[model samples]
Target: MGGGGTLFTYINKSTSHLIIPFEIAFKYEEKGFKTADAFIAAYTEWVGADVLVTENRHFLACHLDLPFKVLTAGKCLNLI
Candidate 1:
């Protein structure tokens, strides 16, 4: 949904829920912002909810510097 090097922030006011889902369809290089991290930060700020990121273990580990727990789920889950 965004170009490379562009940092975006999204906020949800209804509830406290942060979810980050990365799709395999998109090609990812070993550079730039990992979709997981971006989603987590944005979700956390918007909803003030905990973050849930479901993606390949390797990819998630490479991008996330903070502590995170992996969950088994699809990438097309509810975004907000």
Candidate 2:
């Protein structure tokens, strides 16, 4: 869910899976990370995403509870 910037390969995918939050307050309450990261995790879970593509170190931390499989952007490139 992290490749929204490069519109070439992901616009349609995002549009199809978009999950707009009906409520934002306390939506993503994970600590030790940015609000965006927490929200991404929550939203990914809400939308039933199987994989989360990103290179963020914080997301890979062992202490985090990430529901989806986390892959580096480079790793996704290799897999594709």
Candidate 3:
């Protein structure tokens, strides 16, 4: 299989996939998050995730209230 197909298979088999509701995403948007960030945040909250990893400096610096922790990829790796 090609790399993309292989990656898709791995994700399909190994990940706990979910669909985030529009209301939840919209709530984040109202809280000042951009469209993509809103969905990401909504998914994190909906899933009850412990941490949300990202390299975006703005997201890292934001003081928004959220249930989960946010960390850089390096910081997440270090915790492993």
* CA RMSD, predictions in order: 14.0, 7.5, 8.1
lDDT of 1 by residue, 1-80 (tens): 45654222333453444333333212232345466545544444344334444565654556444333344356424432
TM-score of each: 0.28, 0.57, 0.73
Off by over 4 Å in 3: 1-17
**Candidate maximizing lDDT:** 3
User: Global lDDT of each model?
Assistant: 0.42, 0.63, 0.75
lDDT of 3 at 45: 77
Candidate 2: tens digits of C-alpha lDDT, residues 1-80: 46665422333466446655635314555345467776767666666677778777878765345566888888787866
Q: Give the number of the best model, judged by TM-score.
A: 3
Tens digits of per-residue lDDT, candidate 3, 1-80, equal 55654311112322346667889999989988899988888877776666788887767999457887888989876865
Candidate 1: segments with Cα more than 4 A from true spot: 1-31, 34-40, 56-59, 74-80
lDDT of 3: 0.75
Q: What is the lDDT of residue 75 in candidate 2?
A: 78
Q: What are the runs in model 2 whose C-alpha is more than 4 Å off?
A: 1-28
Worst 10 residues of 2 by lDDT: 6-15
